[model samples]
Target: MWDPVTDAYVASSDSGAPPNGERFMLYALSQRTGLPSLPLTSIGYVDLIDSSAGAVGVTLVGTPATGPPATYARYCVARGTASVTSLVGFVTDGTTRLELRVRTDSTAPGTLSVQTAIAVAGRDVQLSEAVTVSPAGGDTARMTTDLRVTSGGETVRATGDVTVDTTTRIGSGRMTVSVNDGAFATLTLGGPDLVVAAEAGVTLTTADETTLRALFSTSFELFGTVRVLFTPVPLSRASPPVDERALVSPEES
Candidate 1:
């Protein structure tokens, strides 16, 4: 059983204080919720973490030795487009659904954009860039990432020039996609020779948001090279909720 008075995962000690191991575990789990480990020092100072850690507007401040500061000495930090505590889970917008992305683009607040059949909202995220979004319900998000986006709670990365095309639908879980080098090559899109890596469980859903356009919804490992005919089309939700449709034409002009 858990003890509230002692705050231990198990029973409290005779001294009423938790063991060193218990304290470490409790502190670590708390970090996942945007909570700081605090003034982890030998000194008596205790740092209190705030709740708005992953948001883009949080800030901090520090007291300089030269300045009088306030009545007492203190340190502070300012939030600079702060990102999420971790790279797992989902971002729901009530009725809609979306995913988060990371990129290596030079553009700030422009590298990332929300994509859908109707409209999108963009953000600037880069390599190793972590973020969090609380949708009104269950909205979908298209993203850009340089890290190998993994599956099953952002664990393993699927290496390749990844694309959540007109027929893509990530399931309800923590799906991570990290772009590890050399695993993928280029593709001459629109050409019959073009091919894509189809991992297990990774489904390509249609614009209707109900149709199963393409099936390969799992973890796609790189066996060969995938070239890029056009620039890497970062995933986005646009006019049709989905694009990059495959077309069939007549033989005769």
Candidate 2:
């Protein structure tokens, strides 16, 4: 079963006795009733169990049914030693689907990296970010991000490094953005609001302007200080980290 609110898998079952035949089943708990469950729509399935196989193999896939069909898709499961080290998922706003990838930093114990890509509607955007939690105290962390957006044969890129106080949920940093490798526009953070300023003689093409507007509309609040559009999840209220290595095998890991 799956919990829509938490977006987590709760339970699973297999029926019909293994040796003879069996069928795998997936379910989701109804939010309205919270008693009876609902079966997930299975768009695809793969069977890896085989008696003739030379080695034991396992493949697991997850399909989330809570969100809009066009906006959500199944994720691939990566095997880890003690937990899931890597994850791949898809999210969309109907017009475009963004590919989201997340993984723990093997070299850095308490660090995480998130990458996102969007290639649609003549636009290609990619973002790579690294977030590291302070080992001395979990109340603080650092995030470094790089973003690139391309459209109509033009390209724009931005890079930022910020320190965040997990306890206060406040971040301070400066992001520098450039269009077509031209002069950069800087956005400063950590003050009352985000502040943006461009270098002298910075110019933009018609296509570049359109792309920037679309990006700002979807990702930032530009009225005063710029703020990213996101739903904040406080670390204090967040679930404990799961060791992804345990979820996968040695070969997969």
Candidate 3:
């Protein structure tokens, strides 16, 4: 039994909530339409190729390499292009360039752009650069960071960490991918190259909404903060959707 008042899982036999040590499934509406909204038996987050995180954007702000403010602030952030919130770390020598992995939406191919800014305490600076990259639907692209300033050379490397009060916030959101179930099959995606530590119920945001939205729309399962499950659920694990056509090439057919 579920007590909407208490907002927790409970046993039908007992009036109280399930014991801490005891295990139970929480129920929720299935994201997949046509199917009854039941306890989501499977849940997981959106996984980007090569990296653990989804699409992300970063901005680099700095001061003149000469005086007043000599250090540069590297804003490691998420979203298509938004204000800097958290600081991953800092580097000096006038942040010359930065590399970022941007994810591509399903319908928007070959169209990817990210913005970065650099502020010089007492000088003017140019902060937008464009680079071309090739990425598949629901994939990632490595972008080059561009920054220019008056007086000093256009290129600068990190010298040291910048002293700034910033919190590290990981982006989280609901996502779903499908996979084939023929007895049992294993799928490997570029191996686990990127690592972002998180747990259930953590709110997240995606840098590339197009890709993730399309994915969840067709996905049989979903990854969310709360694992809503039906009273009776399956014990099998959830996996990304599989494509039979991709398995066999034109030559094979």
User: Which prediction has the highest TM-score against the true structure?
Assistant: 2
Candidate 2: tens digits of C-alpha lDDT, residues 31-59: 88763354444532222333332211222
What's the TM for model 2? 0.50
Estimate every model's Cα lDDT from 0 to 1. Answer: 0.24, 0.43, 0.25
The CA lDDT at 149 in model 2 is 67
TM-score of each: 0.20, 0.50, 0.19
Task: Name the regions of candidate 2 deviating beyond 4 angstroms.
Answer: 1-71, 80-84, 88-95, 99-104, 121-138, 203-253
Candidate 2 lDDT (Cα, 0 to 1): 0.43
Which 10-residue window in model 2 sums to the lowest lDDT?
223-232
Comparing 1 with 2 on lDDT, the higher-scoring candidate is 2
Cα shift from native, residue 9, model 2 (Å): 8.5
- Residue 131, candidate 3: Cα error in Å is 3.0
> TM-score ranking from best to worst?
2, 1, 3
The TM-score of candidate 1 is 0.20
Q: What is the TM-score of candidate 3?
A: 0.19
